[model samples]
Target: WNYQFLTQLGYPSNYYAAGEMTVSQHLEVSGQPDPYNPGWVGLDYIFGSGMRGGSSGGPHIANLGEIVDSATDPGQFPDRNTIFAVTSWGYGLGNSSGTEIKIQGASPLSGVANANNFVDLFNAACRRSRAHFGTWTCDLLVP
Candidate 1:
């Protein structure tokens, strides 16, 4: 799974403040015949706003956190039917110090048959959030 903030021109945004932060977490399954197995491998990654910006750069871009399950049923082979679940959040410069901005999502299997499926889901979420905030453009680069 992936998370991104697109600029008004469909690029990325650069917005940051002191003590501001963003994070992402997720689970994924890899190297498995059946992508729905519960024994799949898991992974997690975290990104936070530092003295400057996050790891991506000032005005953090995309922060990607995901879990991968590489364990297969042993008898099954690899296929494009892999399933993945992911969640992410973003932080922008706020008026108050220590204030935070975040976004998150969870799905049983996401039911995404392919990469495009996942992309569509995430893009929709971003657009929705942007509309609520009244922000036209933003930058998104996963770290």
Candidate 2:
């Protein structure tokens, strides 16, 4: 999911938009240094999207669809509709004709460098939420 504003729309309009994108690829991008800041390491998934701005930091959900029963389709993990990433950035070309083709990216929730750290952070957030809301239901499914 993303909230993007078409650059052509110009400012003053204050017309921001929201939309969803299909995961064209679940990339395992690791060990890459940030081009802008060499000291930082990068890990993310790159996918296709339209040419609009302000989509960064949106949640990228996984298993986002109707659930099938285990009896009908066994060997399925219990986690469904889980957000596994957030929109990081997008890059591509655009023309004056307003036909823009761009690709976006996000850092995956797991299976990369510092994955354990990510898990810890998630669990910490869950714990904080549980405490703040006075509910014991906030928990992370850490495999």
Cα RMSD to the true fold for all candidates = 15.8, 8.1
Q: lDDT of candidate 1 vs native?
A: 0.33
Cα deviation of 131, candidate 1, in Å:
1.1
Q: Write the per-residue lDDT of candidate 2 for residues 71-130, one digit (tens) a residue.
A: 755444445556666666666667868686666666666656555588788788888888
Residue clash pairs of candidate 2: none
**Candidate 2 structure, TM-score to reference:** 0.54
Candidate 1 is scored at a TM of 0.22
lDDT of 1 by residue, 22-113 (tens): 34222322233322347653232222322222323312222223436576653332332222332233345445666754322223233334
Query: In model 1, how large is the Cα lDDT of residue 116?
Result: 41
